[model samples]
Target: MRTRALLTPLVLAAVTTAGLTVAAPPALAAGPDISVTNTKAHLDQLQSIANANGGNRSTGRPGYKASVDWVKAKLDAAGYTTTVQSFSTSSGTSYNLVADLPGGDASSVVMFGAHLDSVSVGPGINDNGSGSAGILETALAYAASGQTPRNHVRFGFWGAEELGLLGSKYYVGQLTTAQRSAIRSYQNFDMIASPNVGYFVYDDNAVGNGVRDDFTAYYDSKGLPWEYIDVQGRSDRAAFRSSGMATGGIFSGAETIKTSAQASKWGGVAGKAFDACYHRACDTNTNLDLVALDRNVDTIGYMVWRYAAKDYGTTTPPTGSNLLANPGFESGAVSWTGTSGPITSGAGRPAHSGTWKLWLGGNGASATESEQQTVTIPSTAATAQLSFWGRFDTAETGSTVYDTLKVQVVVAGVTTTLATYGNVGADTTWVQRSFDLSAYRGKSVTVKLVATEDSSAQTSFVIDDTALTTT
Candidate 1:
């Protein structure tokens, strides 16, 4: 039912890349710090598009197609290869805008997507404009960065999601087994900037849990709290998951009231629905929570970089000789400096392979933490490889502010960034990340993991099974 007028509308509102160059083995680059202001600009454009084509961007409507065109144009201008996939919907012919960033592993693709259509009632800015605009802005950021990732990143602005996931289902149906298997992970964002927001993470599956953990880590680092909301079959993710694809995402909330406990933790009024305008004509630009929108958009970039930026080898590493001491934190931060305090170790949380893991930030904990250990290389070794399993969650409040995780190589007095991870969105599952240390083979070097949390909205960062070996 259209409920805009029946609920209170919160006052909060408002809220990329390219390049050439083949550099040294890609050091883990920081995901672009997304701009809330730029996100607001996209919302304004969507609002304008809706205002001109009819009062709504609904399926089979002029506004819906126009929204697709506008998004496609931006992607094209930014150098993303774009395509419009047509599908038949009850309302009529609808289109989905699919944009691909070239130069990643085609066999293993990572998708960041959102539904682009609104219900027929209003502008639907909050119900979906929040998500569509957020994903669109993140895509543009990727183009601007020009960083070649390890997995192909695909962006989908789906149509008819409001009409029962018609567009997404169609798109998924068109994929062959090979195509489906190529999708390593799919992340969806819907209604992320709800007015009276609650930070909710989608807990769909094991992979979804990893995604949830990433967001959990981010909120933890920022000193924010979150709750798990099972949204199976609730959004476009339903379609992808139904097709056997791994998926995860974030939602600010909708219609669900903020409990007193939630209010105490998140600092919002109790008894108020996260969004007062769910599927109503008043879900306009003014109906959003700027803070929520900004953080989620930044998270989209983080997840893209962490998951899409690397190739998860098809097989797990064989357990053998590992050189780093206290590799899994099972013995607690021993052999590492600056890590004896603040670091957490224990059971309960899922681990990559052991009963313990090192947590850089705990749930709802905030601080800048680091752990370093100097490892002496055997003069006889001509090359070395560094490997570790890590998972994280970082939040971006704006273009210049966000949590971060960096793995560094220090020799003498100089520090070289080996890799970085942040805005993990929801990565909770353990994934292995490796680096070649052949460059420092002959010298004693300090291998360090540093985590930095912003002043607000922090999450967690975890690592396990560290190893350095000559191969």
Candidate 2:
């Protein structure tokens, strides 16, 4: 959670007005609302913990350890193997707790965290007690659901946040390079129930685009007004984002006063601070707005449930550069694989460069067509890349992913889809796309571009001037 000094409002525009390109996803069954009363009860317990120890669950303090133990005991009973990571801080020793749910692909993890320790002021309930309780309940609910996940689920409760994001930074710093890469997304929640609340979503990095879209879609479904928060170095997300993982999360306003316009939109007091008790002693359970708390918790639960099963392809998107023969189809089917029909010029869809671009799936029928080439990267090569100019003109509309062009890589007979471009963004001009293929060095693999069309609308993926090169 943020202290007043660190609460800088980077960008406060509504989600719809934030100039984000939201990819349409199918409606998510957000599941039933997980006991808001129970969530609130957790807030009360944290409050009591603070009241008993020192009126604050500050890092290196007895209340903080007690808080961690209380939460760990609950998770242990729920069948989670938890880890408590200890690190040194100005306060002497601080800790971070991580609990990984059993089952699911550990290779790709979906993580969420909230700062558990609070300022040494009052009981710090709304400052972060709200976020901690919400995430705790979500974790418990997922454990009890009996639903096996596709992606691994992990939850974290960090110590020493008010002392400048120390615990989260330590947790992230301890991860190995491969472990860092394995985290596909990280969601951080802090100050979620400010008395005067305004909904906010994290937005940064193109990699976070898909996750950002999911949050906005959830809010839109609930008729909730959400804005984008830059987050920068304000919270735990900055730690993971700096380590090269895509991150997204929810935040209610803190420290900043609610403007008349914001108050008009979200129904809060116009001229008052979002959390009049940001890091002060008055930040107790009474500092919360249950209505906003309920909505944000449900949204977090919705994302956790959906992403646990999200398919991130069989392998990381193939990354490298110029190893394929007839890379652009300029020489037709002589050095490539797939339907020869896509190599021709006159069947429609202008080429990105030469007249021989690969044109797939303009048949307006339920069909699939592809173009691929086998390439080998030397083990000694330090860098490789795959680049191409392409565009899709689609007859389909809305966010429904009707027609798609799957960019895939095949290694050891396993095809991993690097990306799936859908029918939403149609264009009259070509766009350039590239991926790092260096990860496939020392192996020969088939890099394929496949397009599939629905029975109704026609979508054409026109490709030209492709190159996979090593340097």
Candidate 3:
């Protein structure tokens, strides 16, 4: 996940010149001592296997299969229930190695994953052997050290990732709708570090900017220079994010070069892709900068330990005020008013009654012209009270249908049916729907409303004064 830059000719030129001048140097600061004797040992094993097979751990290759077995044996020895989820593509059969260290909320999980397959080009030593080695080391360290993470921590070693995040995509797709909802987050280590050096962090675009701030805080605190890069599906993190999970990872530069500007910010030679070997055959064990690799291992390991373990504290419940309040000029909320629009209908779908025209809000929320808008309440609240105003027109034909509506709170996509109201048939007046989301307590919710439909479907409905009050 860690890497940066767009390769313009100019950028390349700058990197080449700067790289020649700035030799890959190791970080002076000492990383916490994790017994990586095993990590180093595993690296050697992977190297030997790679060297034995024409220096390649290509997918479907014997060396790759051997690598999978090696990891499986280690997990088994560590008392993890190892399972191989296999799939096939045009290339060949690939495997995703999953092992569970059941703990904490069995339902809520924290996943730690890395890709085990290397590029067909060479032993793929630095390309991923490094990541595989690091993860193997970390997992074994956790087992040997006798430290238990509070949350159910799952480990995965993906295959065919170099081919485009295939393993992760397949894994995420296999989860039942219910299983997907229980995941807390995913921490990925694609390339824990590079012997080539430089530093950067992977950014998941779906997530808010808070992750970046968290990284800055950590790097700045350690006086370590780091850069940020957009995450490409080149790794497993991208796949997790695609499934709506939050993701982040550390990297020590790759084939992409650091710019003068980046170097100034992160203190690396401007214009060099953090690591020179990248995917090349030269990406051997010797190419790695132990200093950079060591620091990254410690930095990421600690972060995983802290967040995945949930050591910070329990999340607080939303307040009664926050729950009862509605958004408006009073609560600093923005209003989205719908104008008259054509009504469409279709057969019943899972989440919708019929076909509909979806209007996405400026904030990226979907809404209908006749239905109420959706609001996402912040998680910081202790107890929240949500209130909104809805004006409905129940003027119908043969049936005496009520001008009713439904309000719901969706926490992490799991909807909580809150309240349903009938505005009294034929009533074209605004009714207040006050719902106490206190049951959600510590959870954040995306508020949703569906106005009841009648034969006399109105052209449009107006909603205003939506507020979520926090105690």
Candidate 4:
């Protein structure tokens, strides 16, 4: 990781708050608890260390190792047994600092983690340094408050995170099968607090539970505008999610630009992305908007206090497999009897070309080889109807014309031309074409496609979304 020098003075003067100065001690404002406020100062200390060393804290680097030492020392001082899980990686030798707060039932554990590695390009202030500092603050606060969470609470500082989650995957992979089962939930904070002005609560639950709604209600009750995002395999949460553990976190912004519409809804400036430094060297101490960052830290503290601090609810197994959640047609087969034309090679035809075109030998270069699949779709009698949508691409030879398309349907073992279509010229836009099979309502309709016109033409038809809809 390389840090770029920002010759320009950070725009810290623009964010100065009344009676609240970064240069002064951080005790004038309200905090979760007195200890929690000190935790914020803890972040300030880390930020100072990272900034002093080339404006970054990256894995295998001196700044990164210093950050690890600081966190491990903090955990050791907190009366917890600490372990340094070191592993070799392409980036270099790195380590994940883990500390256990064992509970009455050590069998069940709750994990709270944030990647300690900053981006190689920048100080990674907003990307993950923000997240790491917040976790430190929370852990210190948890220690000072003497809040004994029921489940064993584990804190982690994952290394080499900038190298595509290598540290987290290693930690998860090393766990024995029994230890893996003991994990009840994983709450990871990758970029909890950014100088970015907007708030987001990620939804990582496999099933869309009322998590987002609950999170919204919690923040809205505090007069805050909170945005919702799905944990779509963006960070360390993916590791826990793959192992069937409930996962979720909060993020300000990484590198993704927020549109004007989003900025309008949220009060951040438009055109500028949520976080400007994202993964750049400019992410120094002054790069953050502390007002926004502190608020997000409190937000995360609130969520953890409510969910991981104590057990208010239990997680249930999913009712159904994700397979049925979004079932899709993989492949199928169709057959048609027409003018027996020689199967052409080199050129493929679209499956939507109809039967008459097959008789004319102008459908396509290749003829149907055999019947592959016959699907039976069931629909409500009230609004049952069969419809098909397909796309056609003209032959590539740049010929004056290409193949024509048609379709055939089988009802009660009787074959007939259900729909007829003319030549579909090559066009880039999707042509929305439909056919009414209302006559076959509530019945199994077997369908086949043809692409035979001037057997010499090599046009092809691509078919999609063949369905029986109740409309």
- Per-candidate TM-scores read 0.61, 0.65, 0.59, 0.57
List, residue by residue over 1-471, the lDDT tens digit for candidate 3. Answer: 222344332211112223444434443333345545656667778888889887877678888888999898997787665667778856798898887653343335667788888777667666677777787777766666666556656778888887777888888876754356556677777665565466666666466344445554566557666656665655587767777776777666667666566666556577667767776777676766666667666665665565555642454323443222213322111121122221222222111212232211111112332222233344565556776555443333445433444566656547666865543443446666677766765443456655544334332333455566667
- Supply the global lDDT for candidate 2: 0.80
Across 129-155, the per-residue lDDT of candidate 4 in tens digits comes to: 777777777776666676746555677
- Whole-model Cα lDDT of every candidate shown, in order: 0.74, 0.80, 0.59, 0.57
Candidate 3's C-alpha runs over 4 A off are 1-32, 208-214, 261-270, 311-471
The lDDT, on a scale of 0 to 1, for candidate 4 is 0.57
Per-residue lDDT over 1-471 for candidate 2, one digit per residue giving the tens place of the 0 to 100 score: 756453455776664543566555446575558788899999999999999997988887898899999998898888765777778888868888887775554457789999998887777898788888999999999999887777778899988888899999988876655467668899989988888999988876455878887888888877677888787788888888888788888899888788887888789899998999888999988999999999888987888898898888665233443555556665444344455367776846777777778888888899999866655566777787888888778888788878989999887668999888878886768888988878987765678899988898888888888887777
Q: Which order, best to worst by lDDT? A: 2, 1, 3, 4
- Which 10 residues in a row give candidate 4 its minimum summed lDDT? 323-332
Q: Between candidates 2 and 3, name the one with more favorable lDDT.
A: 2
* True lDDT of residue 108, candidate 4: 49
- As for TM-score, the candidate ahead, 2 or 4, is 2
lDDT of 1 by residue, 1-471 (tens): 122334453222110012444233323344558989999999999999999988999989999999999998898888776667788878999998887774454556789889999999898998799899998988888778867566667888889887777888887876656467668788888998988888877776555567667765665555455677776555788777877788888888888777777777677789988787888888999999999888888878788778876656643123334546556665443344553344344553556665667777653446778776655555466668898888765544445536678999887668999987776453676688999888875565778889877566666777888888875
Off by over 4 Å in 4: 1-40, 207-214, 312-471
Model 4, C-alpha of 71: deviation from truth (Å) = 0.8
